[model samples]
Target: MDVIKDFPIYVAKKIKHETVDDLIRQFKGLQANCYDLMINRVVIPRDKKLKEIEKDGNADWRFHEREVKFIVRTENGSSISVEFGLCKTIKSLKDYLYDVKKVSIDQRQMTFNGQELNDEMILNDCEIINDSVVCMNKKNGMSIDIDINNVIEKFDENTIVSDVIKFRKPSNAENYDLVIDGKIVPRNMTLQEANISQQSKLKFQERNITFRVRLCNGSRIRVDMPPSKSILNLKEHLNTVEKFPVCQQRISFNGKDLTDDLTLHDCGIKDDSDVYLLGRLYGG
Candidate 1:
């Protein structure tokens, strides 16, 4: 007898073996007349995803990655039609558009099926797998001729300055700086939101291995930080160099919450890493 169970959409299937090939065959059959399965979950690389599935024998049976496709349209009449994992975010689609079409959208206003979408929203929410269309209404902006460390990048207005620093093409650097007209742009803000325009003279500040930090108070600071150092050490260093209060500083690395006692090595912080510092002031 086949080990049968209900699938995502109430369809029934069997999983005799937990291998990649086994899972593919099972999902393929479930789609039957359809071209392929649509998944909106964070589908890691095939090898990695499979490794993870196989590693844990008692894994939550419902936590398998699904394959999905999307059609993203912009108000300019341009559209992006591609397949991605359901675990991917709308921001991922925006990043893809920025990479291929050289255009970006303000996610704050981008919507699908008349409903607004959030950066954290997954493809599953759109219910678009095969031929669904996501409408993009014009709201904010895109990037052009923005120079970073001597290299030029065409960014969408909605692209985060820090994301650009952490994930620029060719090679990934640990840290970077976005400076416009002698003033540093906040990594968290979009280009258009930051008053960055096509004609603005933008510059990227980068060092070989050191990382930079942007405080909440519109100030920028650079540090010669190495991955071998502990987060505690860096906090102490900041307290001395920038007069920042170590105890009052809350630092996050790669979106991971940091403990004051953890080291860069423990937190996987590397050279050129981007560090975000939240400092607390004593009095107004």
Candidate 2:
């Protein structure tokens, strides 16, 4: 009787252990299956969207290094189009387009918002983004103002300027190779005489580099940026630079929150490109 009782206890323990092992195995299988399903679902759609956004001349999806195809409406009402790596600089774009259309580049001035276009501006890689940065339908008048106050405003106090100067093209204004105006200033000029302060949104210089920043509407402030800096860091720097109140405002790239510390390699920012930073969209 004692042996039989002990035998029953032993068998019960073994069965219990086997049951626990089976549960663990089932859990692992479920995790693996879930992982596989998620990857399948995400990767397929992502791949398709990427393909749709990508453009090529022959439906081949061959993206250019820095080329953008422009839908230019000629003066004759005919919309002519062409593609080239626009990043070769403003000068390069004018020269090449002149060559293609056989018009003296001198006759065709690049004026973004009326100010002659500068070669330092890099054309964004995406066709849609590049399409938006407009050029001259008219020559924007250029002038210099003398303000002893040494402060200017692109708009309201939400964005103030340290005697803010405007960005201009290479030939439009330069202190020589010394100051590009919006670019590297003569490493030697003190802020007082030049009065060129950090609060300025746009400035030009005759320098080499393909970076530009554009603010949307008038956000009580404007921030300057270097070309190579990532949009992620750029946004943080903008917040700090502009003194944005914590949680009062949110920032977005194109139309999305800057999720990661994404490099320009991932951010897709270009000169004068529209970066919509507004009150975050309201939704459930």
Candidate of highest lDDT: 1
The alpha-carbon lDDT assigned to residue 199 of candidate 2 equals: 52
* TM, every model: 0.35, 0.25
Worst 10 residues of 1 by lDDT: 1-10
Write candidate 1's Cα lDDT for 1-284 as tens digits. 12223342232233454444455556555332222222333333332234344333322234354556666665544657777766567888778777877776544355543345777777766555666656565554543556666666666665555545644621333345767777878755656678877756677655335677777777768787655567788889888988877889888877766887786767866656778888544775
Off by over 4 Å in 1: 1-20, 29-143, 169-174, 206-284
What local distance difference test score does each model get? 0.59, 0.38
Against the correct fold, how does model 2 do in TM-score?
A: 0.25
In angstroms, give how far residue 57 of model 1 lies from its true place: 20
In model 2, state the lDDT of residue 191.
33
Error of 2 at 104 (Å): 3.2
Q: Which residues of candidate 2, in runs, are more than 4 Å off? A: 1-64, 72-79, 113-115, 125-130, 137-284
Per-residue lDDT of candidate 2, residues 1-284 (tens digit): 00122322333344332332232233334222111111112222212322222222222211113345665432222444657554346666666667786644454445332233455665532122344333422222223332222434232211112112222222222222323244543322223333444354333332222443334556434444554456556556666876554344455666667653565435665544555555445678
